[model samples]
Target: MHRLKKSPKNARKTPHPKADIEAIGEGRRLAHLLRAKRKEITKAEQVRRILDTAHNAHEISLAENVIRSTMHPADQFEAFARLHHEEGMAAEDIAARFGVTAAVVKQHLKLGAISPKLMQAYRDEELTLEEPTAFAITDDHARQEQV
Candidate 1:
């Protein structure tokens, strides 16, 4: 490849000895530089694209609100009450996995919207509620100790 001869027109195009020398480090010289710069884009352009995507998501979330939040503050407590208060999952068992309080679980039970039968089941040991596969509590201090 080093021995390959260039046409007179090629010499007329780029008449620089340094360009030829730099072809080894800079990849085939002047023509490549022009091509690479033309191909490159900017980070600002990528971020603009991501923000456009979020704009569409925000619109949908505004419509669904509570349902959109999945397990919100009160929802987390309610789910726990069903599992522990009704299903007989002990306070410790609920706390170990959910990382919350026995009292908080009880509070959610009182506040939740589940069926009376289900609530009674958790309390009576007649039925066991399965903990949600995954959930989050929007309540920050519920799990936090006060004293």
Candidate 2:
């Protein structure tokens, strides 16, 4: 009788001993963990490359524009309203962009007209949110300052 030896590829994947099988599973798990670690290291290296690279003039300009567009909501809305009004855009059109009624846009424009001191006071948390609205009810800067 002749015995035929199994090639490495054709050999049984699991050992007959339970301990050997468990060790093989653990080794597979460790290999998977190492692969994940390697992927994370590659991602970190890519981030470092992006941060260390010198940006061109256009890239810098784009970054500046993005930063400028990140103004506080109140200030940003006021600026948008003011520019729209200055550009002869209809109140209704501007209101559509703001997703508010024309009346609300008009009221916001009124609030936008308030003195810078009052606006700064509102921004500084020194005055309640309603205080600015009350000031907007009257166009008198003297009265607004008094409040």
Candidate 3:
């Protein structure tokens, strides 16, 4: 039977080897995800390299895992509204940029046009998303707010 060799019991390990391994794993995972989604090998490689070269790679990985969140629906509506009204971007253009359907963009536009008071209510969790979406069918801010 073959015997496996083991390191000396007192051998010193590399500094923060666990952290380094975690950072490398996170970078590889992100690179794989980006490549799979965008089909951009160069961009994926750049992202991986950037993560690998960070002074506190493990901290960055931890922050990304712990702090990052999906954009809130209300925030998305407001952003889409701003792009359409303030930036003069059409629903189709916004849809293309966001990888959503034009119909979904239109829905967001409608929700964005809702009364500011109601939007605030939505943000505060006083109203459900469906309620605001229903109100979006009308352009009358006063009527929407009154209801």
Candidate 4:
């Protein structure tokens, strides 16, 4: 068996009219330049920047803070509950998907149903995690606001 000769790294598949003048070597460099143009975003690094700037500058903060903090217990529960309640998913199905009990799903749904203002405050750390429980116990937004 005869071994085939390997092509040069800088060789172009198709011969261009300007190949001699411009050279196939530039093609490899151009390909590398194009690849280097891509933006690589590390989510952890992005979140760290957001968290570092959150207290100092509100304008530069991440709009989706809940998503950035992927492991926060309350965020997970609230997101699942929101999916179930707002998206019309069954609580049992949500429980099955999340590996939690139906009662837990119901509890999260109740918490997710709290007033948006209170929820935002909770997210911003202005209110304690448990503070929303009082509001969640009742269905009335007006009543929740009163308290």
Task: Write the residue-wise lDDT of candidate 2 on 25-111 in tens digits.
Answer: 233445556766878444233221123245464655454445323334356446655656677777688789768888877767777
Alpha-carbon RMSD of each model: 26.5, 27.0, 17.1, 21.4
Per-residue lDDT for 1-147 in model 3, tens only? Answer: 158565543122222334444443465665578786786665435332433563676767676567544456777887888889988999999999999999999999999899988988887789999999899888999998877
Whole-model Cα lDDT of every candidate shown, in order = 0.45, 0.60, 0.74, 0.62
Error of 2 at 131 (Å): 0.3
Task: Choose the strongest candidate by TM-score.
Answer: 3
lDDT tens digits, residue span 18-108, model 4? 4243322334444555555654433233221112533433322333332222344456556776677577899899889879999988888
By lDDT rank, best first, the candidates go: 3, 4, 2, 1
Over 51-129, each residue of candidate 1 has an lDDT whose tens digit, in order, gives: 3343455554454443332323333555666676467887778777777777766656544544433434444544444
Name the better of 1 and 3 by lDDT.
3
What TM-score fits each model?
Answer: 0.27, 0.47, 0.57, 0.48
- Per-model clash counts, in order, read 7, 0, 0, 0
How displaced is residue 110 in candidate 3, in Å? 0.3
TM-score of candidate 3 against the unseen true structure: 0.57
